[model samples]
Target: MTTLNLPVVVSARTKWIQLFLGLVCMASISSPQYVWTLLTRPLAEKMGVGLAELQVTFSLLIILQTFFSPFQGKLIDRFGPRRLIAIGTLLSGLSWVLASQVTNLTGLYLAYGCLGGLGTGIVYVGVVGLMVRWFPQQRGLAAGAVAAGYGMGAILTTFPVANSLAAYGLEHTLWLFGAIFSLVGLLASQGLKAPLDEVTEPASRFVAQSSRQYRSGEMLRQPLFWLMFAMMAMMSTSGLMVTSQMAIFARDFGIADVVVFGMAALPLALTLDRFTNGLTRPLFGFISDRYGREKTMFIAFALEGCAMTLWLMSRDNAVLFVLLSGVVFFGWGEIFSLFPSTLTDTFGSRHATANYGWLYMSQGIGSILGGPLAALMYQYTGGWHLVFGCAIALDFITAGLALWVLQPWRRRFMQQQA
Candidate 1:
């Protein structure tokens, strides 16, 4: 491409920057997961730790997301996302380097749990918020696209990072990861900043607060918001719980035969799962655009709830596989995109990122508790029956909460107020 004048480079970059930024942001966020598989055995053996001790990193990671999301959101409002993401990415690289030297669990916690988690919160907010701004017309799709990048990061880095580990060992692998983090982060961040006009415009001065411009704080006060939160949390409780334990669940329930049945198609199915999730967000967003964003959210919430309900009752691998696939593909897909768009419905365009940021933070809280809750239920009952049973209970509860949000009642209230 021929270089344009000074203004043109900036203009060209702004329009296309989200794609680049999204990729890097996702790469850094996904590193922890690869660490989950490749590093698990070596790190545990070297550090003399158990599975539970190592697993604390996951809970702590989600907990940090809860703490840092609002702060990152605020930073996006205060300073443009460029600096926040760049700095966060750099920190993550350094954390990996530091993690490489750690001989104890405490050091691992500081390196991966604290630094990795905080850095991701910063970078993820920036990339995702950038997508929201670029694709205001398709909130679900945009959400899904950003999420898909994040989820897929491991796939991209897994092989390459693993190759490095195979040659260098775990200690050296951490340093190599740090180097990748620093270089990719710095390079990727070059495209991250918004145009100056967007940066200079103060967010609050532009807020159209005539009841529609919803502030995150004010959103918390709305009964509708709580209901929406419940829907996401409840549905996610099952979807994520299953996701956290999919391989083990598959083994326990005789999933090998069913998965083997799809062996020829499994790779395609995984791609389909990711693509369907990514595409569903945008497709659902288009649906919301035509029908009504709130109603779209309600429907998505109900679908997700039902998916969990089905999973909870199924014993056959065939049924389990289908429901699990659908839940992640469409069930969570629906909510992932639906919630942000609904924020626009309730709050209008002004505070979509900030408002939605707080809403998504609810997921972090639910994620932390969901795993242990499911595990405890299994410990006592020795199967997924009780855990999935709780999912069914929450399914209706969340659906009811969703109905209160942008459904008939919320609609009636808005009409009367209007």
Candidate 2:
């Protein structure tokens, strides 16, 4: 009997596959979180809904994460990241076209919230999990590289998106975005595939306990689980705060152009952060593997929290001077890989995919909370000062929490930790 093969190759060409995966994640994240404001007003005006009501479209997409992410994780594990990514990219295109055809909030929710949201979740899990496996020793750098691609998507597409808005109008612009997203994403997502070794039989409470398999659920019972989770979430929340409000905050702080703020923030932040954050992943992961996950996490988190607090307090002036992002980019760049490194170190190698899935979820959670929280403060209190103050407070509290939990978690998981 003859059997068909996948025609896949592992070569120099395969690097593009990883690059595509990064872009797919970039485009997926950019649409729902970063670019919403650009679309929100026009869509609201077109649909005759209030801004907040239109904003519900954003809320629903995020809210759906609770439902979609797990299933996406399942699909990613089953079919490999490449197939799911292609399908998701196509679906995302269709969602845009459907959204452009809609005239009401319900339609918007159905297209953007239901379809596009889930598609993104699927593509994200498979691509990201694949990236980790591809660069096993370089997880943090890999994570940052992929994440920075995501960060740059909005900027890369900004021109086409704007040009479409001018030429096509609101409804047609959605259609244009849909088509463009699919093409670019499809091109980028080309090389995404899970390693053959990733398949596993479902098991409980067993930690995969080694690099051979990493199970986050099993790790949850370990003390290091909560510590790393909290550490990542805290640092993520601060970055999301910066992500969520930098443009508006820049304008409020006397910058003439909010657009410039939007354009500059991600590149500047990601440029430095991705390198440091990525390099830290393996370094810290190796450290935790040798010493302990908890100690490394405690140190990493402490430095991150301190940097975040100091940056936040200095933000008004530096940010007011348009140098605030530089300050933030410096302090806030270390957490991405360290967070996962901590998790992988504590849980052992078996659970990297599952645990990292959970780790990635923190950014999603932070994205949801950070954006509106900053906006709400501005709405209620009438200033960006409160937003800055609140961010500072959160970072300080996060530092204390990191210091308190990590050492103890380390002590308990000392032997099994990476």
Q: lDDT of all predictions, in order shown?
A: 0.63, 0.58
Residues 240-348, model 2: lDDT tens digits: 6655555455546554233344554433343333334334444554454455444555665455555555655554453333444444543454455456544554554
The deviation in Å at residue 321 for candidate 2 is 4.9
Worst 10 residues of 2 by lDDT: 200-209
Residue 237, model 1, lDDT: 68
Model number with the top TM-score: 1
Off by over 4 Å in 1: 1-16, 31-50, 93-95, 158-175, 195-211, 254-279, 298-329, 413-418
lDDT of model 2, residue 11: 53
Residue 404, candidate 1: C-alpha displacement in angstroms: 5.6
